[model samples]
Target: MNEILDEMNGHEFKFIYKTELFNEILAMIEKKKISMENAILLLKCIGYYATLKGIWVSDFERSLLKERFEKMIKNEVKKKEKMNENLLIDL
Candidate 1:
């Protein structure tokens, strides 16, 4: 749990692609209006599905990922608030 939180605190998302599927994923993210972290998590899950054949992602992994994603968003929000406060004070 701590490890997950740590990773989320400094997570960077990137993917390589050149297909309609990539555009579809972007469309869904935009439609949902989700955070970048959520979009990256979803993309990771999608990649797992596309690459892995018979192997399956366990329910445990899914649950853990969801929890971590939420934590990441919360942390980001807090950071943004702090930055906004500093900006307001400067202005």
Candidate 2:
């Protein structure tokens, strides 16, 4: 996965929704098997990987990608807040 992400500069990134890889990434984030920072890094790079190289992505894929990643970020923040609350309660 790191290799894929590292090589992202040359990737087409034309169809972010083309495979189940996105779902696997989200699952890794949810399971805390991957770092939140890395997830955010991937999300940030998606557009640059396409836009910088002039790759035309479809509207459907763009919208879906935006919606899903935004949702995952929000959920992560909420979960972190809840966990912090529990820690405070213990204190």
Query: How high is each candidate's TM-score?
Result: 0.29, 0.47
lDDT, candidate 2, 23-88, per-residue tens:
666678778898756765665565455566666545434444346656655665688845544322
Tens-digit lDDT track of model 1 for 25-85: 5566557767545667655664454344333323323343445445655665688845544
What pairs collide in candidate 1? Answer: none
Model 2 worst lDDT window (10 residues): 82-91
Which segments of candidate 2 are over 4 A away from where they belong? Answer: 1-12, 15-19, 58-68, 72-91
Off-target runs (Cα >4 Å) in candidate 1 are: 1-18, 27-32, 54-91
Cα distance off (Å), candidate 1, residue 57? 18
The TM-score leader among the candidates is 2
lDDT of candidates 1 onward, in order:
0.45, 0.55
Residue 70 shift from truth in candidate 2, angstroms: 3.8
